[model samples]
Target: MVAGILMSLRELRNIYELLFCDGVIVAKDDRRPQSQHPEVQGVTNLQVIQALRSLKSRGYVRESYVWRHHYWYLTDEGIHFLRQYLHLPTDIVPGSLRRVSKATARGRAPVAQSGPIPRPEGQTDRQQYRRIQRLSVDKLTGVELGSKPTPKPG
Candidate 1:
């Protein structure tokens, strides 16, 4: 029973990623080492497709046609569900959730911020969203710091 629930939750997380990212461009966005392909490696396009089908049953995600490829996005209900799950501020609607691939000398489990604790059966979507958000914030913070404040020319 626990395993079944966990499986469902994993699918849910995948759906969220697809929806949040506005559907990963199958032919563009070549930033990762695995970006140049029919699908990104490690990220597993099949897993994402499976998750999309599963979440379609829940009516939270929908597919759209853009030229020759399909795009994914959250329905209003889906967005609402994410907001509730993440306990986000009433005014904080997420813009997007892009995936980041860190090239570790060896694969390491990426650390993330603590959010709403999981339901023991491994409800990982909220946690994963928090993790993604934290990473984005950290990246932006680094960029901000790395950039010079500005030239104080007299």
Candidate 2:
């Protein structure tokens, strides 16, 4: 129980930093291909929700849904809280895809990567799956199990 709470708190902090670095956070979508929308390994969608719920209740974050997607944004309070928590000066506010600071560039993460995204090659179903002919267990080949023979067709 204690470990779970500790993990949740750590996830909450990680999520806070994510929102700090990127102005907005979008909930994970399983409908899309993972390759197209690869998720960061440390946090799962469920954990993001659990952490966001705590932040939302405290007025630190605002939530919205658009085009069947959930988006979370850090409020002013959230920014202030994060800055305070990290002992960062209040002047260093970075927006989405903005460079945080020159001094911290060594530890900075790129907001976006340049270059065309590689698309996966298409494959036919037959190429992906093997077809195996198996006998049906529901009934025998010539007659239904535990049933009298049908009357002769007239």
Candidate 3:
């Protein structure tokens, strides 16, 4: 009975691992790796949806939709589940969740001064936007406009 109740998550391991690493996954942006067969390629977002739904039914993930885009967050149990699947230590911290340095944190925090905000260095009241050169598609494709193609050796 217990075995039947707790279904294996082998097939959904990729989705679980993605959540463990990213904390949260945007359904539209989710993609699985390509398979061995050339024609198989990779699974689309639909596969991600199926995996998420399976995990949700198992109480390992929570789902929310915003602006017609689905979002999934890993639950506490999901972390454990992923760790078990990956054979990782329970205290493993994902790269995305790395701690911020004190200086970086301080720079981002706003000061509580009661005076008016100061202007940034080298900036006047009005800031002009600069127009940078756009990349040329011809250059990108190695086919420069008006350039003669070299003949191949016979």
**Descending-TM-score candidate ranking:** 2, 3, 1
Top model number, lDDT? 2
lDDT of 1 by residue, 1-100 (tens): 1212333555445445445545323323233433323533344444455555555668877766566544566777877777776555656554544344
Query: What is model 3's C-alpha RMSD?
Result: 12.8
**Candidate 1 residue runs with Cα over 4 Å from true position:** 1-18, 21-41, 65-68, 96-154
The local distance difference test score of each candidate is 0.54, 0.63, 0.62
Worst 10 residues of 3 by lDDT: 126-135
Pairs that collide in candidate 2 are none
The better candidate by lDDT, 1 or 2, is 2
Models 1 onward score TM values of: 0.38, 0.49, 0.49
| lDDT score, candidate 2 | 0.63
Q: Which 10-residue window of candidate 2 scores lowest in summed lDDT?
A: 130-139
lDDT of each residue in 39-74, candidate 3, tens digit only = 112434656666677778898789998875678787
lDDT of 2 by residue, 16-35 (tens): 77778776778853333222
